[model samples]
Target chain A: MSRPLVLVVDDDILLVAMARSHLSAAGYSVADAQLGAEALDRLDERTPDAILLDIDLPDACGIDLLQRFKRRPELESVPVLMLTGKDDRESIVRAFEAGAIDYIRKPYIHYEMLARVGSQLRIGALMHELSERNGAMTRELDVAARVQRSFLPRVAEVAGATVAQRYRPTTALGGDMCGHFIAADGRLALFVLDIAGHGSGAAIVAVAASGVLQRAINERGLDAATLRGELSAFVDIERTGFYATLVVCMLDTRSGELQLLNWGHPPPLLLERGRTRWLSASGSPLGVGIGPACELQTLALGEGDRLLLYSDGVCDVARDGFELRAQALELALRDEPTPAAVAEAALAAAASETIEDDDMSLLVLQREAV
Target chain B: MATQVIGIEQGRLDTSSGDTLERRVADALAAGASEVAVSCGTLALVDSSGLGSLVRSLKRCRAQGVSFKLLDVTKPLLRLLEMTRLASAFEMEHSSRSGAKTSV
Candidate 1:
């Protein structure tokens, strides 16, 4: 291992030499700087593990310089040991407040200097290790977040109809997921689900659930009851005690027919001529005992008609009240905006409300003019 | 058999609270209460984790053959429960209802 580097800043040449000899003998690399400017220049060249800064310097006040060093992002964590006169009690206190880790009085004993330096070096090393470990954990979380994003569907167009979707998680990973695929019979199958919690555990369940639903939809093509059954079997609901609200839709593109099954999620909106109508749910959330028969509701979509699906997070917060938030959303859609514009406006409105943060996902589909 | 009324004071029951509600219910059962009623009069929000805790507690009550119910359910919570089809699964009384029995 490389010897821990120590930067010693003092106006006294003899004291600098003495500290250097003792620290070098005790397995430390010593760098000397007489002025605060010299010390900053040395920092620019290389970062030291610990700094031995004198309270009195030629060019700058040592405490002020210490504060400057602490302000720098790269040198903030480096241990700073202040060198003070034995009677300078106020400077000692000021040095500490200015971010000095430890201090040694002037006319110091060689052994005492060595001991303080050694102890601080060990602490600095431990802090460095902890910082590195946290960095590694954050990198791993970012990778998991990327993997989660990969599963999100990029359904810009489905069967000649325009589609736009957005997902915003309260954390690096969230439980909200949406996907779409066109069937051989010209029907577009799309889905949006929100697992009960947020974070890695919920995200893991979300990924598993997404895979299961994706497979079932591709194979069977929009069987709400069978899809629910498959999810009940696949998810270890008993072990995890987790559940999710989902909406599955199959739209016959040629005939403008839309089939929707909402399971315990927020009601989807049917937007027509700048007005909004809620398509409310009748079924229970999944993994909650499969209690009731989930009913599939069929509707007819006219030209220029749009469907908006969103997670509960978008609508949970209240304005004057929760009901007002829905009305605010309706007012935003009054201009008959595109899917993306509608999403942007809804998110802006949601941002203005104060409430607990949850994963928000919005998917909008609009039929083209005939 | 005595009824134990446990009130939820917090506005939200979510991942941050972990399994506090479940633990409270477990404590009620351990204390030999034959019935448990959570007074959600102050509760305004519940996420998936909170819902999970409720379900787990309900299942625990069922396993021990104890009666469990939620009292003073808020409109927002009721909407969530109804949408999730949990309203039927849980025996709940609306907040406006009167004359329900309570024991300390």
Candidate 2:
């Protein structure tokens, strides 16, 4: 591999020659400029990894040159070391203020110069590595967000129900998810869950939670208790130190009987004939303090009944005082007896400026007369 | 609201009633300065815990004899204070000298 290039800028011919010799010996390619103006011209031709600059230049002061270099888009990230005659505190401070990475006094030792150069080079290499890592992570997050979004159940009309859903991630990818599957028996099984944390790890857990829920639904055949137990077991076995709050509901389309299981999740709001109440179940959040068996909450859904399942992110959206999220469900259902309208209204209520505290997901299900 | 300043550049320490920021404020107060001017400039990032720390420091400064004033409150820091309701507690000004003049 070719040696890293180091630019040497000074008005003194002897000093420039000495620096070139020392830097070349230390496995660095050396380029010399006698004045600040010449250095600027050379920078226009080829950018170097580092610059050894003299404070007093023939055409312009090194501090002024440093500022100019900082303003240039190309040279902004290149590290510069200032060489000064006096080691005064003010000058040293000024050098730093003007964007000098380090400073060396007049009549510098060869070892000290090489060491400082090596240190700055290491910093530059690390910075490049970090930038590349950040780029890769950004791309990965974009893909993850897309995949998480694809996993969500799109807005559609159920055979015997009206459905509405909304999902918003706090970060590029979030740990909140909601989905529904029409069982072979014509029962609609839907769930909303929030993993304990945010970011990529949390997203991973969210996906895992989804996988666990799917497997349980496939194996246990819509038994809410058995599915909850399986989900809790899966979380325990993973040992991710991450927990999830979930509310799963299986609505028997033929009978309109809703079997609900709430696992440390925000209670689902039930609205029927202008009356609102919470669907409560007895279970701890998955992988939390205790792993007790979840008790299913049974509710008989009348014609035009609406059930809203949400993550805590929706309820926790408050500015001055707590906004009663339960009330949001009532309002959403009151206007229209449809699930789509209810979900849209709830999202509108929780919408705010940038920086949402947590991810939000909602699943609204309405029972229609079959 | 409590405010404490440290270093020549007047680095700021703003806190409300809390235990987290008390130690940092006490250290600043014991440094033997009669009045400290705190500047919120250069405080690039703050988390929820860091906000708790600032509130604690303010309470400690008030317990001591030293006076606290906040200057150059950046937008991000101000937003944090607003979220926690600490912005209402302290007297904020553009500069340290102005902060002193406005104090009752």
Fnat, 2 decimals, each candidate: 0.43, 0.00
What residue runs in model 2 are displaced by over 4 Å at the alpha carbon?
A87-91, A155-160, A171-173, A197-202, A218-221, A237-243, A252-257, A287-293, A300-305, A316-357, A366-370, B1-104
Q: Best candidate per DockQ, number?
A: 1
Off by over 4 Å in 1: A37-41, A71-73, A109-115, A234-236, A272-274, A317-320, A354-356, B94-104
Worst 10 residues of 1 chain A by lDDT: A316-325
Docking class of 2: incorrect
Q: What is the C-alpha lDDT profile of model 2 across A1-370, one tens digit per residue?
A: 6788899999888888889999999999988898888998888888899999998887898898899999998777789999888655677788899899998887888899999999999999899899999999999889989998888754355777877788888898888888888755557888887776678877887877787786676566557567666666445412554556678878887689988877656667888776887655456556543335467778888888888888866754222223354465568767764566777778777664222666889888888888
Residue B57 error, candidate 1, Å? 0.8
> Which residue pairs overlap in candidate 2's backbone?
B15-B54, B15-B55, B16-B55, B21-B57
lDDT of 1 by residue, A253-360 (tens): 778889998887888888776567988787877887645767889998877788888887788721136787788677665554687788888777777775447788
TM-score of candidate 2 versus the correct structure, residues matched by position: 0.67
